[model samples]
Target: MKLENRRIWITGAASGIGEAMARQLSGVASLLIISDLNAERLLALKPELEKGITTVDALPFDLSNRTEVEKAADKVLATYGGVDLLINNGGISQRGLFYETTEEVDRRIMEINFFSYVVLTKKMLPPMLAQGFGHIAATSSMTGKFGFPLRSSYAASKHAVQGYFETVGLELYDRGIRVTVASPGRIRTNISVNALSGEGTRYGQMDPGQAGGMPAEKCAARYLRAIRRDQWEVYIGYNEILMIWFKRYLPWLFRKLALRVGKV
Candidate 1:
């Protein structure tokens, strides 16, 4: 599980937690592949990240596009022979009521947040299984554990991530493939501002809670620690993480508090 000299590929590396992970992993990994939809940002980040890592490759592709994901995966396997770690962190958020959101918006969110993870993992699994050693990590949200207003679709997608990875982890644990499902609470990221609305337009506003959340660098540090320890599931955040406990042990209270919190 040690990161030193490990070959790693991380999606959503253009910003937020993924970017922080790239920066931190660059110093430890022997070969680092950073993927994102923002080609300009990924290209700009490559040199900086390369200064630490032995090799850094910037791969830009839209996660929602299945064809693009397959192509990227093929390129990685063809060139590098496969990676020791695959972090499926590319995803989009939602900020709309269930009744108000369109089916297309829900599908789009699921496509990026849920299906993209599966596609990448499926394409990468053959090599991992052949090598009998690999690590996969997916970024889920606090909403993945429970629910919240204005996040119906987002929560559903994250919940799916939780279920899928947990099952994958169980299935592959005996085969030397480790899976880490990271359920991070609100981190100081632009997820809210970039969240899709009911009409599929950008929400374009930052929530107060997100603005005051933990720093992305700190969150990324915690994530790496969990990975190093080979933890199956890790939750990273401040007090918001306690909500998971409340939901598990005190569902009634959790429901009450959830209602009181209202929309973000």
Candidate 2:
């Protein structure tokens, strides 16, 4: 779908891919609603984005908190009536072994990465369905397609996202609603550094792979392109995306390589 004069709401807009998307859509989208947990950062970004033709609104709330997410969604719907595009991009990552990770950590990750998206989408669905036209784009990870070490919960959450959106996409295809699930391999973001550990604390370290991954802006561009073309699934990354093919066509080789590369 075309972005021009479209009303768009993007979560996780304080940084990384969401921020890049907000910047890129500034002049194109008629109304831009940027949501994030960081109120200061969202407020700071609002002015920069509003300099263009877009009317920018910053919505700050904790995605992990169901009540907060609901309140935020209600506010958005009440204020804008509805949006043409909803990007569920706010999510936390995991960086602990399954055996070592607490159940709380897993639940927390699911709350942010999976449940939050569901809540927001459900809240926004009524209006979109009433209008019979809207696009929903979500940021799933490469792990959504296949498993990897040190990302058990993260992968599970993303897999859930992938399944949910695919089903939704199929159901909404003929109803004038579109869903785009973006499985970005790795973009240069603070996901790793902010990932939860076994005990639920921050991992606080950047993985070498993430540091050298594709730029967030590039990933955002690819994601938007996929949405425009009404593509169901789009993978954005460097050579790491090749792993998805290996897992699909050569499971044994994929397993071997996964074991070897997962050690790092």
Candidate 3:
């Protein structure tokens, strides 16, 4: 579980939580493969992160494109033998009412947030199994544990992530593969600003809650800590975590409070 000299691949590494993770992990990892749709940003990020530490490499691709992901996986495996850690962090967010959101929007969210993770994992899993040890981690959300207004599709996608990782952990742990699903509360990241609206447009604005939420660096630290400790799952952030308790122990209060939690 120790990350030092580990070969790690993090998706969405150009910015936000993925960037934070790349920074936090760079000094410790032997090879850090950072992937994103933004080739320029990833290239820009490389030297800053490398700075005489990890072997930082950028693989720019659209995660929604399964063909690209599969090819990328082939190259990655061929290059690194196999990654010791695969962090499934490449995804988008949602911020619109269910009724207002189009079917295409929902599909887009699922494709980017859910299916992309599945596709990349499928590509890398066999190598992990063959190599005899590996870890798969994912970023879920507080909403993944419950639900939220204006984020139904986002919540649904993360819910699927939470469920899938749990099942993977249970099914693969004995096979030399580990799984950790991080159900983070709101952390200051570009997710809200880039979140897809009902009409499939970027929200293009940061929510007040997000601006005041836990810092992305802090979230990344906690995520790495969870992986190091080999935890099956973890929840990061502050007050938003209370929502989980409320939903679990006080469903009525949770339902009422959920109504007033405002747009995330």
Candidate 4:
């Protein structure tokens, strides 16, 4: 479970939390293969990451494309022999009310957030199973655990991630593959702008709530610790960390408070 000198593949490495993780893990990993839709950003990061770690490569492709993911998975296996860790972090977000959100918007969220993860995991599982050792880490959200208003589709997609991976973790536990799900509260990332709007369009704006959230590097460090320890789940945030407890023990109060805070 130690990250040092490990062979790792991280998606969504062009920016935000993924970018931070790539930077932090760069010094720790022996070979790092990063991917994202932003070719330019990925290229830009190469030099910086190389300064931290000698071996850093970036693969740019739309993860929503199953063909692209399959090809990428093949390349990773062929080149690396096998991946020690597969971080399924590439995903989009949801915005606006469910009723107001277009069907296309819902579909888009499901595609990037759920289907992409499923397909990528499916393609990688065989290699991991064959190797008999691998780590699978995903970036879920607090909303994944507790539903919120104006974000039904987003919440649902993340919930699906948790459900699918949690089951997969148990099924693969005896086989030596480890799965860790992260339910992070609001963090300083570009998720708002990347989120699909009500009309199935990009929001093209950042929310203040996200802007004021925890630093990306700090979150990345914590995630590294979780992976090193092979923790099953880790919740990240300030005061909002308590939401996990409330959601677990006081469902009625949690629902009421969540309703007052937003919608449920």
Candidate 5:
């Protein structure tokens, strides 16, 4: 819908695509409750965005922290009266062989990428349903559509979101809860550096594919348009968009092509 006067809550708002989205949407959104684990970086956005918007606030909390996330929901409700839209965009990634990956690595990925979204969504549903109107959009990944090398756990989490949200969207359709799952391909973000390594530390490096991916600002614009239109799903990328169709109608071909892409 029109973001003008819309009260939107976006997670992972400290950096990357989330940060870009907050900056671009500040002009249109009435109350932007920007949230992330890094309060300093969230404040860094103020200089870039504060000139045009009066209703910007930085909410620092770890989504992986269940109690903190729930408290954030309560804080949002108390502040804006209600959240018109909940953007479950906070998440992390993983890389390396599944066997080589530690249990903690996998758990952390699921905790941040999957469990956090579910918990936050559950908390927001009551308020949204009470209002009889709300939009929930998530930043899933192209990995959600297909499996890739060195991303078994990360892919699983994203796939879970696609399945859960798609079913919930239909189940809650009559309730006026719109759920849109955004699947973006390699975007120019610090995801690789921020991704969990097999040893549970930050991956600390950027992959060639991600380093040469789409700009975060442009990706944010594309995603925001999809949210405006209330699309069920939106895939962002140059050639990566084709992967969705490949996975849909030609699974074998997609797999064969993926083998050549060198890790996706």
Candidate 6:
């Protein structure tokens, strides 16, 4: 399916891959609904994206807030009758060891990263089923397919995302409900800077690997191409993507390599 004139809803559109996607799809999209917890950022981004698009708007709400997510779902369903393409990209990263992190932090990460996507999918899927076609895309991580030292909770959340979507993709393939899970190894984003520490405080610094990873716009381009092909799964990033191969074929060596890599 061509992206031109498609109704696309993107979460975490204020920055990173989401922002790059909005930029790429601005003119091609018929209705672009961007959402983020920061309303001001969303409002500010609207004009920058609406010049060529038929319609562009922002719906700001904290994904971690259940009531807010439900209300946002209602508004989305009511507006477009159902989201033609749903992009689940809103999430936080972890930077602390599992032993040091609190349960509250784990819950917060899961709420935003995993359950919110499920909630929105449940809400938006009915309309897709009614219409006989819809797509759901998620920005998972390479960690979703492999294990690492830090980011236990974040990795767990992403793993859950993969499991859920993989099941959905298999079950709904015949129903015209397509699923694409993007596994990005590393990108030049502020995810590391905003990553949660052991006490749930911000890490507040960018990691060198992230600084040197693939650019966000390039990653976004790759992802859009995958979407065009309706790919079930695709990996984005530079050398980090190779880690998936090592994990699959060289589990013992991958474990050793994981221990050797720089933390954060």
By lDDT, the best candidate is: 2
Evaluated at residue 34, the lDDT of candidate 5 is: 87
lDDT of 3 by residue, 1-264 (tens): 889989999999999889999999878898999999999999999998895558998999988787888889889989987799999998898889899999999998988888888888888898889888999998888889998899889999999999998999999989989899998898998889999999999999998889999999999999999999999999999988999999999999999888777634
lDDT (tens digit, per residue) of candidate 6 on 1-264: 468898999999988989999889898989999999889989999998996755997999999999999999999888778778999998899999899999999999999999999999999999899999989998899999977888899999999999999999999999998899999999999999989998999999998889999999999999888888899999999988888999999988788788899444
- Candidate 1 residues lying further than 4 Å off, grouped into runs, are none
- Candidate 1, residues 1-264, lDDT tens digits: the string is 999999999999999999999999987999999999999999999999986546999999998888998999999999998999999998889888889999999999999999989988998898889998999999998899998999999999999999999999999999999999999998999999989999999999998989999999999999999999999999999999999999999999899999999634
| Candidate 2 backbone clash number | 0
Global lDDT of each candidate = 0.93, 0.95, 0.91, 0.86, 0.87, 0.91
lDDT of 2 by residue, 20-56 (tens): 9999999999999999999999999999999667999
Alpha-carbon TM-score of each model against the true structure: 0.98, 0.98, 0.97, 0.95, 0.95, 0.98
- Clashing pairs in model 5, backbone N/Cα/C closer than 3 A: none
Candidate 3: residue 77 Cα off by (Å): 1.5
Error of 4 at 26 (Å): 1.0
TM-score of 1: 0.98
Q: Write the per-residue lDDT of candidate 4 for residues 84-127, one digit (tens) a residue.
A: 88888988887788899988888878877888888778777887
Clashes of each: 0, 0, 0, 1, 0, 0
Give the C-alpha miss distance for residue 166 in model 5, angstroms: 0.8
Q: In candidate 2, residue 258 scores what lDDT?
A: 97
Error of 6 at 98 (Å): 0.6
- Candidate 1, lDDT over the whole model: 0.93
lDDT of 3 at 99: 97
Model 2 spans > 4 angstroms off: none
Per residue, candidate 5 scores C-alpha lDDT tens digits across 1-264 of: 678888888999889899989988877887788899999998888666665544888889997788888898888777767788889998888877899999888888888998888888887888889989899998899999998888989999999999999987999999998989999999999999998877887888998888999999999999999998989999998787788899999999898888988553
lDDT head-to-head 3 vs 5, winner: 3
* True-structure RMSD for candidate 5: 1.5
